[model samples]
Target: MKTNYLALLSLISILPLYAQQVKFEDFFTDQTMRIDYHHIGDAKSELVTIDQIYGYGIWAGSLLHLIDNFNNGAYYYKIYDEATGALIFSKGFDSYFKEYQTSDAAINGIKKAYHESAIIPYPKNKIRFALEKRGKQNELNEIFNVLIDPADLYIIKEEAKDKDVTVIKALYNGDPHTKLDVVILGDGYTSSEKAKFEKDLKRFTDLFVSSEPYKSNKNDINIYGVFKPSEESGTDEPGAGIYKNTVLNTTFYSLGSERYLLTEDNKTMRNLAAFVPYDAIYIMVNSPRYGGGGIYNFYCTFVSDNQFSDYIFLHEFGHSFAGLADEYYTSDVAYNEFYPAGLEPVEPNITRLLDKNNLKWKNLIAPGIEIPTQWEKKDYDANDYIWLKERTAMNKNIANLKRNKAPKEQIDAAQIEYNNKDKAHSDAVDKYLKSSKYWDMVGAFEGAGYSAEGLYRPMLDCLMFSKGTKPLCKVCADHAAKIIKHYTE
Candidate 1:
């Protein structure tokens, strides 16, 4: 075969720093190689060991844009064309393993291992796969690197498991390779609840597509429902004294945070997801409780029947899909200062404002807008603290009641009071913030990335900032649009 290194180099010369420099066909096959591994760590250390490598259906990601230039994850993995020393494919991602290290257990010196996986377009020849993680300074540091040979006899060639899996196309507009492929899996729905799962999938997808970037990019997206019915009908709620034999092993009270729902069974989740082509995973648990979680490029989980399912589904997807950081800081979270002080965050929405000389999104900043813009932060923070404090106490009481086997009436009453208090405080802030003067201003607003004092967001009220009645801020929309294009463009 002939080569065109000069032309290819010239083609990518004007491209972004992380853009793929090699032809997709020159190095990759149509299939995907899923590298499953165990990521083990404590507060101060981490390690990853290969579990198995399997052929996961077709490659659903962009064939034209093989390299990821987005750079929006706590951890990143890149595949190199060893013969030519050129980058072929890469992706930025966050994992439950990394998030787990921030928990009280790990911080207190408890060690644990998490099951995880990363998939890439299958390569034709030997290639080098390097896994890199961000440090406290938020710099990309290579932690693990290995050479993968396609002809190795040890490479597993198993078919997609769960052949009985019933998949329905929820949103199909284009080819998998040319469009964003999203797979929605049901965690605790049983055979009897398959219809409900389908219905919820439609509802979830409808709301998701109605959002900013997704609303405009509907034609370039494909959504599917992969139903692996559980024996029971709801996820395990450890704090609520309820447990179920769910298919994906999802549970609430992750890291002692009541609402941080997650699943530790990555192997099973990936196996179920293997039933279809997927660029991202959205696991909807069959429950009415208010809880969910998202890990970048890994998966996002939401409780399907909750009152706030729609909002949470989209919010968590922002984290898992586009790597949007949480702009709200009042609520309790597992991590301590997840965003570092000096370095810039990889997410598009939040900024540390350390480099006033070079704003990350200075081009989008409207003229005359202050860099560290002002808002009703004192008022916003005041109401937010009241709401969060009450909510925390409410959750704590409910958990205790459940543990004591208190009457169902008592539990319902506690939730009702909390809900009423939540509604009143939310209404007060929303009314004040929604006033014409403060809305839609795109600048650096103090209080974001889990810190009310240090971090600055691009807008006053955003999907990341608060659950207010506003679409994504302009900054968020731009970042999300780029992510959508990364898959479909």
Candidate 2:
């Protein structure tokens, strides 16, 4: 028998492509499935239990990219076909519970339960769902596993809540499965403020597509706005003793950080977001407060009327969409130690720089550039410390004024004073950074990921690192492009 070597080579070349082409119809239907669970735990221990399974809506995720190649987030959920035991779908996501576990309350052993959900394509048959948490060294360890029967009568199949919610199609490129679909939801916008929501949505969508990577790939993206009115017109501000009857219950002062805006009402948020096909969720709060928050693959929130609203929207979306880590270390944060001492973070933007030769962004580094690149850290930190102190003091003063029922004019005056000082400080910092010899270089810069000494960022000034609307660093931008390709290609 004669064996044709050319045919053998051709077969070998196409085998991997065939394996990568996982047919959607073979394993999944066109519907979507959401598995709601209660995440209960503290700093030391955690547990997950099923709350309810929901079936509705069309799957907006890509059929070609069934597996998450990017190893991000604190937790990953995987689905396996029960009959063949084949891995079918998987995604990495961070939850509010994960952040809470790092808080002072969790460190003191005050356990809490958070409602979380994992959305996936509806399975064709029974499947095994496994939830894994990242260990200290960043290795995934399975913490919970359950076999789910899609045909079970217990699975909720009723009409989705908020089905009548108004949806604004801000941008429509093409099919959602072929484009990166982003759903924007509004909180604290009353029925009378529907026009305001529409205007805000248009402004944000335009700004988003105008940015670098998104601008270059605007034809491969879709933006939708899902608006369900709230009774009130502002979010809760616990630091100022102000509360409102918002739909999503978004609040400031989350996890002890005055500017950290987020919501614990995950169920309500998910329900409202279900009105549109979404690869990402953005909740725009109707407030003028300069506060916002983002968690990887979970959701991002920003107040709609802040002066830095545009920057916050882009920065938070970077975290929620591409899992970029915060690169500033001078500001105060609620977490005790976000990135462990010796461990490298899963985020693409920041690293511990454990090995100079094996640096994560080594390929992007220019020739003759030094690893752990040095800048004016001493001088920068000195100025930054002074600014941080003043900012904290100003925040406290404003909060007190609000609590004491001070005159609106007085509060506005204080805010205006702080805003002017803040602008001056920001300008000075930007100028100081621009004067660096390595200003345009892509080498590891010290002081990132909320640590002044150990962790490092790829560049000096990035949207992740500063307050202004600076563009993403080369490494960060490349990662964003890669993620965009994952959804659209």
Candidate 3:
């Protein structure tokens, strides 16, 4: 009876390999629609495409990852006319670019070694392919079928265990800015109080959207909360519940000293991204203290600490939203070397202003504020300038500020003490940066406690880069506007 049931189910199931006829016109209901696939690769590399996973077309913007597994390439599908199997429309779904990731690291390493003479070691690849519909009138490739690993493709489920009621309520904003789909996930503490959790999460998001910049275009943003239960303190201190398994004593002393687990990084993201059509992600963990992180064009994760979660969420969102770099140089951190001095940072905010010609925020700077403005202790807390330097001068893990550029005699002693605590320092820095290990992972400076000085932020002090209340700076606010524009009809 079991075997008979299996056979019956197989007969009723949709075949993964079957090709459905389609017409080019019917697939794209919006005549003015456009799908932009960024980051393609060389043609010499393998390219793969799979068909019809979630009624959407798929393509490989980059081919490096597919070549590694040539036996199976990425999959894609087409929606076309059934009778003639005529070509209609197709697209690439969920493209992965691991090889591109490896090459990026290699290039960065070369830059560090070469200094001023450094160059972009590897050129970005450009991979483009034209897909034909299964039963097109042209019928250029009727017999051929694109092959892919069925498991690699993600099928959108019909229902989710969790949904953001806040997003649904604000779905009717009038301005209709190109809204972003945000999926926010919480840590273990949230499950401790589910009802309040949902209400608080929704309330915060509402407050978030209601705030300036986003307020006028509220309908343009979709926010979802992924609240889960956890057993960790949600502060920025070392070893806070997320780093329990490291071989080293990776504790964040700022928050209450609690054991943290490192494994939750990617898993938390997967759980949240699983529920929405996010072009980018914003993660809000449940914690009262503050801590957060973000990467440009990547994701921003923050804690919902009552003390400063609101501002922190927006500040970190700055990095994720506009590639803004931290402007604050005072704080405790464990990194030995971050900026190379010679190379210009990719972020829009802080820069050496090397080629004032190509500065990302050149026009946004206050008229006379000098680039790398004079290092005046009086201006340390001022918003008109940005700062960057090591977190401490004590060489001990104590929290205090001192100019890193003092006389060499003093530097020598600090360096010596720093060397003595090399293991601990390295452990702390490693735990902070490079914490998340994934191909597209954009956080390496997370956990390191430093940020730019400013007041207008989403929260007081968040993990994004630093804390404080300030709406998205003009640079970030512009980026947000562009993203919103992209999705607007």
Candidate 4:
């Protein structure tokens, strides 16, 4: 006890040095530097070039924890003081560009560009910005580097919006730095629909903070909304050939996956998001299309009026906030071989079980739980694979009918048959999943991260595993807690 007290005193003495007076404020202002760039790539090659730099509004992230400890996202970037050669701000992130490169068109050497942006604290001196991306085997390779001068005349001095937009304080605590700052933006809502955006944003955020880790850590969060109205409502539907005059040209059928909704309008989206100091961005498109997208440390999207909006929001937030992966493997995603085999995924929840003794969430396993956890996986997968085949077949047919401009009657008929078949499949999956056997175990369960063969999840049933009413799995929930601490602690 005496020795323990002495160690505590030693830690207390060194704490002041770690929190030195010449800390974050000495090198950075409270404002944000929004660096916009063009990410050009094909499956064979990829690179980044600076497009624009702006002095955005206040910086809302943690001043003390300048370095991100959570290893997430397909890409990672860092900011270093050129004068002192000190790492200042760093983040792991993903983008639509990275996702696009995995498409079949990209493998055919169809090169393209995606507008991307990152927000950091406004530096007082020259800084070196570097970005590294995770390659095929999860190896980090430096892809882009730039020298930034805060006083450079080329750095544009602009606010978040060109035209006026209402900034609603949906949920605000005292200061942003101590809280996880989230800014919600709406696409495809008209000026008159601003009220609806606010209401919907409020509804989802309330639902968001009320979920597992967020529910227990509510006061540690701040929610803001940027209400940008479009001339017309509803986003684009390329499969159905419907386009609208929305600022952020959000679209469904991204990468030919009908439900994988995302936007290539990164500049416009980031522009509106910077209206408020935000740590995370959520874009709610005004459509009932049952679609959304989420990238780690980037942003998450959801359809505003979908019947499954609540569930979708939670699932996507798990990706965007806690960097959790989709444990469900049965869905047909555009990502072909998304998580490469043999390499352990960095997501907190899912694992390849390369080292059964050192599973990612090994500490969270309940006592006596089997390592390669036993569940009704053989029975579950047998039924799940069948359901996936039917679902994919139905979706492919619908997409084809839409692309060919089939008559409304034919389309309706196709959808009716698909719906009835879907109901039957859903019931079978539920029964297969409802067995009480090993449901509460924390051992690794096979089939996760879009793979049925090698990948495994930490639990049998979870929000990450399914759209069922279960909370996030133990591993996922613990990650959420760690993320909240990253911002608030």
Across 337-422, the per-residue lDDT of candidate 4 in tens digits comes to 77877888988888889899988887888898887886777877777778778777877788778778899899878877876776
Those runs of model 3 whose alpha carbons end farther than 4 Å from true positions after fitting are 1-178, 190-192, 228-268, 334-336, 365-372, 375-466
Give the top-scoring candidate (lDDT): 2
Candidate 3 lDDT tens digits, 379-406: 3243222221232323222322123335
lDDT of candidate 2 over 22-140, digit per residue (tens): 67889999888999999999999898999999998888889888878699999999886776555678899998999999999999999999999999999999988989899978988
Error of 4 at 238 (Å): 1.4
- Cα error, residue 161 of model 4, in Å, equals 4.2
Instruction: Write down the TM-score of every candidate.
Output: 0.94, 0.95, 0.48, 0.90
Candidate 1 RMSD computed on C-alpha atoms after optimal superposition onto the true structure: 3.5
What is the C-alpha local distance difference test score of candidate 4? 0.82
TM-score of 3: 0.48
Give stretches of model 2 more than 4 Å off: 1-21, 161-164
Model 1 lDDT per residue over 1-489, tens place: 124543543454466554544678888889989988889989898988888888746788888888777878888887766666467788889988788888888998899999988799999998777788987777778798777888788888887766558989999997898899999999899999888998999998898888888999989999999998799989888987889998999999888788999999998998888888899999999987788998888999999876567778888888888888898888889996587677788888888898876887787887798778878788777877877887888888988887899999998898778767766776776688778364776778888888888788887777776663457778888988998998897
TM-score, ranked from best to worst? 2, 1, 4, 3
Alpha-carbon lDDT, every model: 0.83, 0.90, 0.38, 0.82
Candidate that would win on TM-score: 2
